[model samples]
Target chain A: MSTEIATGRDIALIDLLDRLLHGGVVLAGDITLAVADIDLVYVGLRALISSVATAEENGVPLP
Target chain B: MPEADDARLARLKALLAASAAEDAAALLAEARDAAREEARSILQDVWREALLEAAAAAVEPRPPPERRRVRQEEGTAVVEPQPPEPRSVPQEGTAAVGPRPTEPRSVPQEGTAWWAYCVVPAAEADRVPPNLDSVDPSGPVEIVTCGELAAVVSRVPLSEYGDERLREHLEDLAWVERVARAHEEVLEAAMSATTIVPLRLCTIYLSRDRVEALLEDQAPGLAAALAELRGRTEWGVKVFAPAAAVAASASTEVAGGSAYIERKRSERAAREEAHQRTNECAQDVHARLEREAVAACVNPPQRREAHGRDAQMLLNGSYLFDDERRSVLESIVEALAGEYEPLGFSIELTGPWPPYNFVLPSASALS
Candidate 1:
């Protein structure tokens, strides 16, 4: 078994979307546009209402 | 295989059509183990802090109510009576405008950009098998090596991914799903090959030279992150309490008080006590899981609309620990679930995911 439990039935993709879009290393500045560079859109789309404050508080450029 | 197994295989095949058969079989087996008879397909089964402060701060954490309101009724952002900061929510009014990039953006309006997916040591870069598809398949997935750092990239056409274009694409749920799936498929393939430091989705550079510069500039920090994150995996533990169950738990025997004042007071106090108890259950669970995790993060609970559930979330937590302890951690969560079931609490364990939660935004944490 894959050391994982059954969770997020329909929403696993949602969680994956959250991580793909928000989680992972941020190449902050310099050079071209990192997703992080131009993320206010995606951040606002899926996470605006729910996670903006947490993102702001954590300073993670998320949401 | 049994008929049930065959049915599951069919479902997996339908939900994901591109996975290699071997992977499907393997995930099928795991999904079988995770079978909770919930009548849903979840192969997509896809952190923390200082002990005291984080746990304390996470209880019922609420941002400004205005900020919490989405395009419900009014797409207008609430102007703070006193205004905390001038941080504007761009296109806040256009949220419900339906899958259209409404944000105003100013930058790079021409030429293609290399969308970087993840980085691995140059030594293992060759192992990141090619031929895999990416967010945009304008070019084959390739690697750019700078010293010991290697970036996995796909050359994307700028017309479809430019600042304004991409913002519009992000608004389209169908579009984001397709792109997100493609993005994750690349990382998952790389992961199977070697340890990787995943770049946030949509990391793009103007040219190969810019990508190389990134490898050079972030080398030490990146290397440190790779070293620190080498074998660890991120697992999520979410505790949910169905509304009815929690409500029943909150209601107490009203002491047969015939007096209206007495019954009213008791009922209100009972609800207050129940709310406090729920918070305690959450913190108690977090403390227990924290002991076993090298790092932990308590995320804001996913709203009911977002999760598509009728239950109230007690905890939405992520924990990172040695991969070898995966089964052990699973057991701990299963046991915890049973322990809290009586109080209307249910815990779920899902993981073996790429270490997304562990990547410190500032890799300097390693330095």
Candidate 2:
């Protein structure tokens, strides 16, 4: 039988993402950007949002 | 005839000379008075606006309609006439305008500057042993007029790195944690010296000129706000149940089964029922805790696919409370945990932290 052991350090990547992106004092402003930079953030974010959505649809919980 | 002509000419010349001299003096006096009034008005208008904006944001839901007109761009409020009206009901498949409507609305931007920060007085900063300056040698520490409030500012602009790549780094959780931890350290320094009104994270200014402009524009009310926040601290408490424990609790005998296979089948059904109940319990517990807080926010819970190794369900939260009530709040958590223990739930609470989630740009600053 294979049972997973829990460690204090073993925080899920999604948990870390939640705290980092959504938590803390958010001070938003007119953020300047270049085309390349915008493309990078856009692509990365789209992938993340879709991946998480798919996981939820499949009945798998995201960390 | 000759004597008469000479006398008239001399008299006319004398009159013209005196009038010109008097006119020059009067013009100078008028300019001086205007200059003085302009200086005084600058101080009153900007400071009052900052206070009103900060105070307004502190209120619940949307701030005043006038404030919504002011857009925050790079730490400055761009005040323009209202654009075309927003749709009363957003159309289907359209993205939300402004920041997420569900999240907190963007309050008019107003706060103390990056360079001119408030710190505990010299004695207080010293007494703290590890002042913000010591922890981050890159920042300079300046003494402030207010009690124990000292300002610490970085020598170089973070934007100077000119690395658009920096935002990508921000996406990294470890990198974000390092920055967040640094911010936490500064706040800790403030607590040691005096009650601190922490500026929001990633607050950047164009230059020292802007910093001074912000400070000059908003000194008195900002000082008053700092006074109000003195002696307060923030704390966080999260409660969750490990899946295994919850699963085990639910696995009980339904009907007597002579065969081992029959008993196993019953256990499987019981576990599924237990898991569903536990999920619901976590949601209810989260809602109750949020209501109890002076200011509360919930980060999305991580699901089992990502954190499958963990035993407990995840509920992320933060609370801002008076320092004196710290023990009281802890006791409340203890009581809640005890009450829910029979249901297989546990609570974990942490902090005496800086007021990270509660720093709204007050409305008073907008006026």
Candidate 3:
């Protein structure tokens, strides 16, 4: 019951990360620092990412 | 130098000296008058002109126009009118203007890494915005070109972005927010000027050479991605079922026990019918959007815990379209909104962003 509407230009942190971390042209390289270890980091960020996502969904304005 | 040229040089030196002295005094006075916006603007103009004159005087003794043009094209000259400079200035003036003149290009001492923002075709290398602030404010964004691709990159301290330190930073929500915003800011600047393949967040390399090597190694794949993204942009569309209205419609009552039982059964049936209708509506919307989009992808519906909304997400889709189709897609969204709003469902449209979803190889292909 809490889903909120969002426009394309909103530039919300959740949306940015959704496109930035979840999508984009990724090239695997030895020297390039990959987000490959993201799983390890995501475990720590799950709470925050989820909260922000929830905030966006609930129409709560993020600071 | 000729006698007349020597005399002109002397005159310029005298002017510069006078302006330098006057500038110091005017700067002090300008500080006192800072409260007055009009006075501050006039002082800024004077300072700009003085700086320009000094720069012109310094370059006066250089070769004539033809030679200077050649040098500029060769990338040795610093004073040429660069096209990307103007666009690099933050339009909102919230952030500091582009990089400072003294910003370091690279740090080779060691324990430093290069964070690459995006890549553009080598032909558009000159279009890369200069003086852009990167995730590391201390480092300025620069381009590393290889064959046909140029990587937009900035140098960062490895101690901060190295595997361990970066992993730690990512855990800090505030830190992640700042770095992610900076990354997008640089991409937005580059996107405005050229077709770019935005690298994923936190993409870093050991050095500039490594970035160039990456460009060389990934040339084929990168080229294909760029070709697919040419003249196209990504848009997002989401549909939500209005929980309150749907809940209200599902609520009903009857007085008698037999009537109540019958009413409950019919209510369950009606609710099931509405759910099916909602699913059908979502599918219809996606089908219509796909027809107008050059490429389309449907993302999994977000969970309620993640979105913090009680409403169920019926659709989450991204579309890629050409520039001219922007209005067409917009109108379609408008029509969809109008048609669905009355059915206890709402549609939201977003984009014209870089083709983030379309350029990447599909997950199945990668697997």
Candidate 4:
């Protein structure tokens, strides 16, 4: 049982983000945080990841 | 940097105001020269900061927090304790315990609220396991039960999770990493003990009563979801096409312009065909795995950038499997890997995670 739970440690940030943001049990409440902001962050993450990938491909050192 | 320099110059200017006229003139000239040098260094610093902020913004569109001196002085002082506040201290005996109910402190800290990590059946309240060491290190992860369901929750400053703060924090990779890991850690701990419906990251409620109200209102749906998820765990499988082998095969040399052009066209066609074949292979593998699991879902293939890998992802699927079927699922994954490895395809299996993909609150629960 411990091993099963421990496997979550191996999950990559992107994969974790995918499930954390897109799936899971969402309980809508009066909390003021915007879902739109999360979507923007997701978009930004995609852009950032692609930029990093392009940098890696070109052998350019990331800042 | 400019702020510090301005303060220093102001002090120097004041002292020079009382000095001899000629001496003050000489001193002021030297100070002016020093200020110019300082300005150049400050410009460079600003440029570097701009570059870093731009990079961070490209990843998550928000202004990065100002670079702090603590980061520069990191080697000198390894740990800096946060400012002492009444809210920082967890009430006695409430610190670092499993699912016991602790009195919620009504500290008048503004813009802070309860962030729920997960909800489990009330029957499993006592069995909620201890949390990971670094997660919510300063707060207690207590369970608040409403009728049949118990929610795992902790206090979070609303300033950090409110619209503006959360947006800024989400843009910062380090902050997101810490919070996301902590969120998962609590869920994993509760999951180790019993069936739990893990909530999405940053699920905040204004008060404990609100949290309990949510649990109460959604009790039936929550119970149903938990029942469906009982004795089951989720497994993730990602399939990738080997980049190195594909690149190697396409790099074969050819003679003359016309021959090179012909080879390039054929290579393009081959690559397209390989991509199509990989997709079909992925679907076939997913279908086989689905047969062996209780429930399954295929998420859209993740962007290559997210994984920081050169290979193209062919499949990103999650399967919910019964405890008894764990071995069968592992063997199927093993067989698929063996069958696919020779064709420049690879499969990575993860979890027995909390059934993140399977537990959705029924539509009626929301209303």
Candidate number achieving the greatest lDDT relative to the actual structure:
4
Q: Kindly list the interface RMSD, in angstroms, of each predicted candidate in the order they appear.
A: 10.1, 11.7, 13.1, 11.7
Put down candidate 4 lDDT per residue, B225-282, tens digits, no spaces.
Answer: 7777788888898887666423434233535345654665665566556655565667
Model 4: which residue pairs collide?
A44-B59, B111-B158, B112-B158
Q: Write the per-residue lDDT of candidate 1 for residues B233-283, one digit (tens) a residue.
A: 777788776464344332333443246335545544655555566667788
Model 1, residue B63: C-alpha shift (Å) = 10
Full ranking by DockQ? 4, 1, 3, 2
**Regions of model 1 farther than 4 Å from truth:** A1-11, A29-63, B1-108, B245-263, B363-367
For every prediction, compared with the true complex, DockQ reads 0.15, 0.07, 0.13, 0.21
TM-score of 4: 0.68
> Which 10 successive residues of model 2 chain B have the least lDDT summed?
B78-87
A12-63 per-residue lDDT for model 1 (tens digits):
6657765665467756322222334334444545464346455566887862
lDDT string for model 3 (B1-367, tens) is 7999999999999999999989989987766654353344345445533442332223223333211111111211111112111222222331211121122233233477788888898899888778877899658898889999898988888777765566567667778778877887787777777777887677677667767876776777777667666776778887876674235332333353456546555654665566566666677788798878777766655545445456766676778777667888889998988899888787877655655666542222333
Cα lDDT, model 3, residue B141: 90
lDDT winner, 2 or 3: 3
lDDT of candidate 3 at residue B359, scale 0 to 100? 53
For candidate 4, what TM-score does chain B get against the true chain B? Answer: 0.65
DockQ of 3: 0.13
**How big an interface RMSD has model 4?**
11.7
- Candidate 3 docking band: incorrect
